[model samples]
Target: MNETLKNNTAAAEVDTRETVLEVKDLVVQYVLKEATVEAVNDISFSLKEGEAIGLVGETGAGKTTTALAILNLVPDPPGVIQQGSISVCGNDMLNLDVKELQKIRGKDIAMIFQDPMTSLNPVLVVGEQIAESVRLHEDVTASQAFDRAIEMLELVGIPGARAHDYPHQFSGGMKQRVVIAIALACNPKILIADEPTTALDVTIQAQVLSMMNDLKEKFNTALVMITHDLGVVAKMCDKVAVMYAGRIIESGTLEDVYNTTLHPYTEGLFNSLPRINNKGSELKPIPGMMPDPTRLPKGCAFAERCKYATERCFEERPASRYVNETHTVACLRYDEPDFHIEGVED
Candidate 1:
């Protein structure tokens, strides 16, 4: 195994006590009619049992594509996992056939997408969705599955345990929880939550986040939370991966990423954090839109907006450089011994 993957598994083992998922050199590409776009460019990471890692990036930064590629859910024709390997428990998932992958997709690996209303089936009852997930993985009768569905609802902090409740009967927060309950109903080893708090109100968002955190500990499931919210990662993830234009710019422990941020894109995320001092001030959003996947820049993706970007940053693509024991960034300038963490004012 490469050193990065080894170290990643080691880092994952720190909190989880066991490695569950390992993704290496994941490259998802989209073959449009006119062009090919690299949605996930050479990304690698791993998750251990009971560990959570947040993948942070803007809307078009290829966060969702990376998540989907992990589950081999990339839509065909337009989208394809062009390269790289993904392994779960030492088994290569990228090489698995459709039928073989299907057996693991929900049974061992589950995902909760951004919009629950769209992701959930409108024709099916909420309980039915959760029960179907259970019955698909386990040998159980319809009645037994329904009872498990109620248990999942209760597990997710939902009030009503009625198995007849439909998606229309629930609010946005409730729908999100139902989606989560369905995701967890199968008792998957790895759960990928993609923008889980997108449409939730502040109070609901916090409650749902708290419930997910509680569920993480209770189920001992490794979590890959893909979100643009820095605060969420700091609160929920033990480690974080900062992505930009299809590649991971930085990866570190929550303390290493938040307390001593190394990459420019990661620092931009700090601008989004809620602050008591900045209550009256305007929210400082990250400047510059993401680069087009079809025409990605030759070097660093954040070069256009990064204040510290040098000619080398744009002229040459930097390799992943390690700073200390637990942090890595794809910036060459930081290879110097005198390199310091940027934007983190003491």
Candidate 2:
């Protein structure tokens, strides 16, 4: 993180309202040679306590970047926290020093990544991994931590109570369970799950999601689930944030995004799905490729592919204007309520 990026963390007093995690005006840049890629543009949103908000986008749309930025885990060389305020559990994550940040990160907030194998240490037994997390954050003895590890593994639906099992002893699903168990061992108030169900079979996915829901309810943890799967988002989230080219295109309640998709980018996503009842129906993929983040097009990045885009969209980016009390979409068509998305179909 550059000094410029580090200094951008000054934040106003938190919104005493229903927000527990507030990611405000965040921008993340990855400098490669002479180029700087805006992995996450000026994006902002809030995650209330016990609320699950899904972040959905195609690969490279900055879903992971946003998550990493919040965690302050952006690696060097290619990444820098450009600007933003990531306030979680009444603390400013970006502004805090590394020592202070570490204390809050796993202790108050946790993350579960996509690849469990890489996440786990090959040398250490799975039990010690979770035990280390508990010991790191809490004043617990090794025996107590080991016992807690077994309890958490059981909570996450791992079959065996053997905390001494090595990472290689577990199945892919089991590895994920262990990863999640380690994440929750510290009893964090916030949990960030990045592509939690990817690389798992459908049955395992459901079970993991069920376990997560149970855990969230039990712990009252605010969850930030990052994924490209609309199905997962629909199934797991109360609110949804749809991103394109590093910026949020639309955001609202699950019903708002599903029932009344205001952005054309979101519409394209919904169109690309096969209806549940229409099994024989053809899958409609979104036409055209995703925009390159490093050299994004002028105005709205999705304008070229958006069916509702107009000539004006080619010139200026649309502000995230309100559609209702809670729903907001970054599209100019909403300026005229009578304008139908079907009008601009290519």
TM-score of 2: 0.92
Please report, in order, the local distance difference test score of every candidate based on alpha carbons.
Answer: 0.84, 0.86
lDDT of 2: 0.86
For model 1, residues 78-128, the per-residue Cα lDDT tens digits are: 898878888876667878898888889888899999997799899888889
In the range 91-131, model 2's lDDT, one tens digit per residue, is 99888899998898889899999998799999998988988
Residue runs of model 2 more than 4 Å from their true location after superposition: 1-18, 342-346
Candidate 1: C-alpha RMSD after superposition: 2.5
How far is 128's C-alpha from truth in model 2 (Å)? 0.3
Q: What TM-score do all the candidates reach, one by one? A: 0.92, 0.92
